[model samples]
Target chain A: MSNLERIAKLSGFSKATVSRVLNHSPHVSQETRATILQIMKELDYVPNRNAISLSTGQTLQIGMITSSINEIMLPFLNGFVEVAEQHGFQTIIYTTNDDTSKERQAFEDLRQKRVDALVIISCVTSAKEVESYCKYGPIVSWQRMDNPAIGSVAMDQFKGYTLALDHLIPKGHTRIANALGRTYSINTRSRQQAYEQAMQKYNLPVLRQFYYPSTYTILDGERVMRAMLQQSEALPSAILCSNDHVAAGVLCEARRQHLRVPGDLAIVGFDDTELSHTLGITTIRNPIAAQAQNAFHLLSGPLRGIDMPQAELCFELIERTTT
Target chain B: MSNLERIAKLSGFSKATVSRVLNHSPHVSQETRATILQIMKELDYVPNRNAISLSTGQTLQIGMITSSINEIMLPFLNGFVEVAEQHGFQTIIYTTNDDTSKERQAFEDLRQKRVDALVIISCVTSAKEVESYCKYGPIVSWQRMDNPAIGSVAMDQFKGYTLALDHLIPKGHTRIANALGRTYSINTRSRQQAYEQAMQKYNLPVLRQFYYPSTYTILDGERVMRAMLQQSEALPSAILCSNDHVAAGVLCEARRQHLRVPGDLAIVGFDDTELSHTLGITTIRNPIAAQAQNAFHLLSGPLRGIDMPQAELCFELIERTTT
Candidate 1:
């Protein structure tokens, strides 16, 4: 017999009653519901939830919004999709070019389509821009500034910076430079503050010329490093980069200038991405996969009925030849 | 009156008729369609196609499948999404861990969901594995071995290698070490063939010890370079790397060993990825963004009877500091 017929026979109910129970109809009695459910359990029968939802006019679909597409965000997106798939939901991705207007439009579009939840990864958008949309559905953000109305999941940038600085300061490096990301970003600001604090704690002088603003790309890092090298000043003993991509750039520039990495300029980087392990660059590790996983859980779990959780992830300092 | 009602009144039809015309229903009469479309144009009505698609399942949606997620594929994915969006359709994404079983499962899942098209960006599966699924949708692949049953989009790896070798051979580097990717990859085999042909053209003896198989990551490049340094009886004048990521590794390891690039060991890389631009590594440039755009056009355009032109792109040679 077919699975559905077997389920009907085991439940000791008519096939019509079994079908109603499977569809979760309001017409079913409590005792009939219990009997049908017990039979389904005994027979290990699994219903096609999507088909049921379709007939009932309910869809458990979520939308994910991201700013531009590139390698830096792929891992996080992959992690989010994996978690989303496991929860029996499909994600509709909307990508904007880091434009605030485009981001707003994407939110409106997804909201109009009635996505059950939204996960945004736009670093440039302010909390106010996304506030109205949150009222329409459960909203969760990753690695951006916190919003009281929506859930947020981000790496502890300040702690990550401290870990990198802590590793460098003990190596007796007094003159240090930093290749940081854009000044406007929360992550960059946090790391910058941590860098300044670490410098003060180590009793080292902080120079304005030593801080370079980069766009988190390897080429940006290299360009900033080259500009710093051309200046009429002595090179720093070490350079602290905002991310692994930028650090790869700094390493390239240092090589071009014929400067030794650890011997001439001990370098440390953030985001201990997969590239870090391959390049042997000493870096501070931020659990990006864990961040994505937690964000998904906050937006889709049973506890979603409650307020979003504010939590910080642990980071580690990985030592390699760059330091 | 609402915009829909106004358009309906102007077109001498109900609001539903205007919507049906806006959605390009095959059932609508040509004269009635022209009248309704003209009314929509006169009213300057902009339809939310995504919302319409969500409500009515008429337009085609394509699914893009990838094995690994990284920076190299970001631009390509972005290009694909932009093209798909422009064609009044959506692109869904699925990522696998480069496992054959996982890849097969992803294909099956997408097929079961009835996506209109599939664009794969990894190793090519067996013809039999993809045959049954291809019957359900059009399948296009990128950066994999050419399969007769599926249309493919790929960079010219042999030409890319020839470009790199042409640049290096003229630079008087007779003894050149090579860092290549996995032997199983079709691109790797093509590049290896080019390397052999180039060596023969220059009458240079092939040094087996100087060749290393490394994955396309900076750390792998570094490890392979270190091993080459430790194992090779003689150092080559230059190194030809598989890609920029690996080239960055070799550059880093050479710096650690206190060997000067170009001075001690000149280098060349492939793909000319963003990392290559940052490091100023002389390499071959593949138009990944263009390839992605073409793939999207093929799946969502004429292949779907949409009004889009078909096109193909080519690769170029970019020279920088490593050579």
Candidate 2:
């Protein structure tokens, strides 16, 4: 009897179940999967990887390195996977939790696994940093670092930020604040530049006291709100949050303080996420699907050698009750 | 010059940078990585995988298949990855989106990749169906079905559902509704059965009309709430939502209709998510970290090669202002 028959005889499962176990089919109960796995371990049967790449080479697997799997990045991931797979490429995700070393490791790991390409989403890894390995295969990133080696498909970061400022400044609110996450992030820098320029244009004093840096979560927003309130500087009439979650936090905090949004303090949020609609917050919608599609076309292009363009998609400001 | 030196010279980067590019280090900038990659491609330098897998076999990589990367599952994933890496097992994730065929494909793919083991998370694959494949390698699942072949470390799912029902019925909620997600899912079935059993024990009729099957999102909760209110059947006093997101929807919808929570309609959510705390909706806390810890221990455990227990971790009912 083959390995399947031998395992079935010992485990009392049917031959088909043993076969299903070998094939990694879900049709087999978890119990059966375990029992068969135990038996396989006992038998010391290690299925190797050398042949699978050869067999499934046509699937054209692309490995995506993500910092963290969260709602904000899901659309980008979903779009990339959906579009890539539609064109016969499968996606394998490696979560590095934003660790530079782990990301570097993933770069090596994917290469060792013989993946056709690498599409990085939401990572701080610079193009120059990974330049050493980029020559081996196609690399695409959702971040824009002005890296020519990597095909870039990012939201028009600077323009997107100004759109928010443009909407807020004209409202006659000179006392404007912003929640800036990760002082080093390109997006944060872009938004910072826009905030300064817009405030300069409007001749509004830069209320640095109202600027909330390193805030990401709702609690951060709440804490920032509390901190800004305690500041020696005069209170700002408006606050621009980094994202909807933080905006929600500010709203909740404002509610706690009995301060009405727009009435007492106008607020704006980035990433018009699902919660933005339900929470009724003014936000900027990052064009995820378009960016993902553009990146996929460049990374998966048939040229195998082609000129990669800086594909910056559009963004829109959604005005809601908060502002 | 060797391939590395040749590429590095052409790209105007040091040999170390070229080696880093080939090695997939993050130290190289994206621009430099891209330039070197372009040079390598021009030189027809395709680094093969067979040798690298041979070199990196000591890394002890384990492949995990996830159904979907949503909020409820992230804790489990985080715990599992943290624990597995602690034990020196590197994880490679393959997302199948809960599609059975794709799950089976993951098994074969992982095996072909030559991973030491496979962990299946949140997939609805029955054990009996995939029994044959389990004989090939060690297979673990995050779900608890008690299939002899697979090792399951899951939340005490059935007991978890009853914990919610037990909390509600005693509060004198006879006219209770439930938001059931995926009628065929094991968790839904467990909750459905528990709902019936609890209602029967309370001597209350099973209000099937109040059961909103196939519900998942907050919008689904809103829709369910709308449907139930429109029904000629007497409106239920409270609703046990499938998850916190749905419960949030119900809460929002109730607010829309000017109905006070726990006054006109009591709401209880499962999977005490971050939103649960923010919204102050009472929810059951699924011990994801504990379950993940158990699953990791079992999957990473030296086969004791013996029988692995179906580790059922506990759940807690968190009561708040909503109830």
**DockQ winner among the candidates?**
1
Q: After superposition, how far is residue B294 of candidate 1 from its true place, in Å?
A: 1.7
Q: Assess the local accuracy of residue B212 in candidate 2 as a C-alpha lDDT between 0 and 100.
A: 90
Question: Residue by residue across B1-323, what tens digits does model 1's lDDT show?
Answer: 98888888777898777777766555578899888877766665657656566656543457777765666677787888887765545666766656565466446655555356788877446656776677666787886646666767776688878887888888888888888876777888888888888899789978767878746777777887788778737788888888788887788778778888888888887777877786677888888888887787666543445544556666678988878
RMSD of each: 7.3, 11.1
lDDT of 1 by residue, A1-323 (tens): 97678987877788888877766554689899888878876665556545656665444456778766656666778788887765445566777667665465456655665357778876467788677777667688885667788788876688888887888888888888888876787888898888888889888978678888755787777887788788798888888887888887888778878989889988787778866766678998777777888888787543133333534579998998899
Interface RMSD of 1: 4.3
- Name the weakest run of 10 consecutive residues (lDDT summed) in model 1 chain B: B300-309
Q: Per-residue lDDT of A152-247 in model 2, one digit per residue for the tens?
A: 776657788898888988888888888997788787888888889888888988877677888877778788788877888767899988888788
Error of 2 at A179 (Å): 1.2
- Clash tally for model 2: 54
Report the C-alpha lDDT of model 2 over B113-174, residue by residue, as the tens digit. Answer: 44667787766667785555576567777766568788767555678888888888888898
- Clash pairs (backbone) in predicted model 1: A71-B71, A278-B219, A279-B219
Consecutive 10-residue window with the lowest summed lDDT within model 1 chain A: A301-310
Best by TM-score: 2
